[model samples]
Target: MKKFLVLGILFALPITAYLFFASGKNNFARLPVLTEKVKDIDQFKTNTDSVISFRDKISVVAFFGSELDDIKGNTFNLDQKILEKYYDFNDFQFVLVLPEEAETRTQQFVTEFNKISESSKWKIAYASPQKVQEVFDSFQSPHKLDENSFTPYVFIIDKDLQLRGRDDDEDDGKLYGYDSSNVAELSNKMNDDVKVILAEYRLALKRNNREK
Candidate 1:
């Protein structure tokens, strides 16, 4: 009887473990795409004069407009709560879109930001106010930019240039962007969503390698 019980327990353990992990994988398989084919950043000019596109990269995008000082707190909240955590991940970046007139201010903002954290993965792009409006409008989200062409919220763009967010959020039924000023939102909701997307890509890479 004891030997039979031991054999049964041993067999059940692997099955139990498999079920547990399988359930977890299913739960986080992929983040739902809220918007498809968001406008790429190729039209904007970067400090390095290099083309920045949304192709094949996970990006956290924000619009600071021309007033960098105004959004300093919001930027810091996003940096500490989100960017600092995922900046080192492969093909993951923070894209801050600013108006063409804010070049000097943007440089100052970058210098100040670098004093506290690494800004290598933070790509700053400049565009005309008209172009900025065009790109923001491409999101098709319910939220709108403020008078300064700025918003406290930041959006998550997947590798395929699609927006990813919750369709059944408790507060906003359809959450399109996270408020950078809200640390709790960033720490709780945004962090989990980012993990889901990153895991989705990692799993894809593994499967592709296996097939090869």
Candidate 2:
């Protein structure tokens, strides 16, 4: 009886540990690819001519429309939350795209954000409304723009520039899922999801190096 009980305890411990880690594995969902890549970084006009691309790092992309609305503050807050947690990481970035008309506003917003920290892993830029609309249509996701406004839900674009969302499978972008209305929940989910993709990319990189 003593030997049987010891064996049972050992088996239960490993199973319990496995269950704990497995439950945390689905913190982020693999959404369908939105775009293979951002071909024309030039189209994403910035105050400086510094070239930016999704070729080498994971990016979090979002449409900010006009900066005069409350959504701008909400978006900035969310970005701040994300930066606070991920500022030290060099492999991730955030790009907030605004309408070309918001060029001046975009500059001011970037300046203000940069003031919070001498360094900013996030960037703000503008693009023609037509180009912006093209990206939204490409996603074919209604959540790209709020039904009632031009503000958009945030999106994760992998190192390969594929758009992602928190959906188990592609739902024609209808994976119009999750709520960012709550800042705390939004921050936790977004941070964890980003970590998931980054982890997967790093693992792939390791495998490729080993193969070579």
Candidate 3:
């Protein structure tokens, strides 16, 4: 019975991980490629050329569905420790896309974030339902949703702009299907991605610094 229990635990772990990350393995996805003409959180109108294109840099593009309650005190699921140490030191960034209802509220959140951290390390952007549709349409999903994206969902993009891993959200980007089941496990994986991104950035920057 002990041996059986141990084997079961091992098997369960891999299955869960596979369910979470396997979707991003496919190169051709329904999501839209990053584009210009998007507005940053500062209400600045800039093209994609002005921002850090993740072509060679590690990037994270998470489409939040706009939960007003999360903003009581600057709510964000990604750990700040991981963000400050790894993301800030490394060349990491995030795109906090806006939902339909939270346009104004999202802007306020951006302001609050800047008030908290004045550094220009990370960035936030807003995308209308139409723009978001450009992404979801390719996947044959409904691009015209009046509501926001469901909770507990995140998308992980790599340097090559390939969707390498995802926590939840179906093939159609409907919602998250948990691999870890527990909140702590999910949170840890999110942190792991940030740490790896920082490590990658350090190597690149170091190489550049040595060249100089």
Candidate 4:
């Protein structure tokens, strides 16, 4: 009876440990996709006449509108909190969508920001006001753009062009965007969420390679 009990304990211990670790990995939560198939930004043109699209990149997108002076501080806050941190990630980018009229202002802003940090991965796309509204509307989020077509909030867009955010967020039930002026929200919530999404993709890539 004693020998049978010992054997049962030894067998169950390893199985229990395996189950515990495997469950941790399998249950790792991904940042939820709040909206699906967001409209791509291919219709816009960059300063270099290059095309920018959301097809295969994890993008942090913002709208600066034509009044670039108003959001200068907001842009800096985002640069320090988010862009400076994840700009080096292979498929990660910070894309600013501005009205075509803001081209000169955008250039000066970019040059000013570059003096502080590398801005190569910071892309600027210019489109008409109507077209900018068209793209923003496609997000299907509850947030709204101001009369100037500017929002102090920035959004996270995944490789599939889907909006990624918390559905049961503590502050807002559904958090569609992060307020650029709020440092705490960016440092804590946005920082952690970005890490989660990046890790999610890395794991997926590893799985694909293994299958191949």
Per-residue accuracy of model 1 over 106-163 as CA lDDT, tens digit each: 7778888898878656898888888888888988998888767898889999888899
Over 51-161, each residue of candidate 2 has an lDDT whose tens digit, in order, gives 666657777666767754556566566656665666567888767666777776655665676676533456756677777776656555556564322554676767665
Every model's Cα RMSD, please? 3.8, 4.0, 9.7, 5.1
Candidates' C-alpha lDDT: 0.85, 0.62, 0.46, 0.86
Candidate 4 lowest-lDDT run of ten: 19-28
lDDT of 3 by residue, 1-212 (tens): 99999999999999988876853332223233333222223332222336434455555544555675553322343434234454544445665555555666655565666665532454554456565544433223222333564333444455555443333334434322212223453455545554544555567669999999
Off by over 4 Å in 4: 1-27
Models 1 onward score TM values of 0.87, 0.75, 0.50, 0.86
Task: Order the numbered candidates by lDDT, best leading.
Answer: 4, 1, 2, 3
What are the runs in model 1 whose C-alpha is more than 4 Å off? 1-27
Candidate 3 Cα outliers beyond 4 Å, as residue runs: 1-52, 70-74, 79-81, 114-121, 136-146, 166-183, 200-212
58-145 per-residue lDDT for model 4 (tens digits): 9999987889878878988899988898878988988998888888777777787788877656888888888888889889888788
Residue 136, candidate 4: alpha-carbon lDDT: 91
The better-scoring model by TM-score among 1 and 3 is: 1
Best by TM-score: 1
Candidate 4: the clashing residue pairs are: none
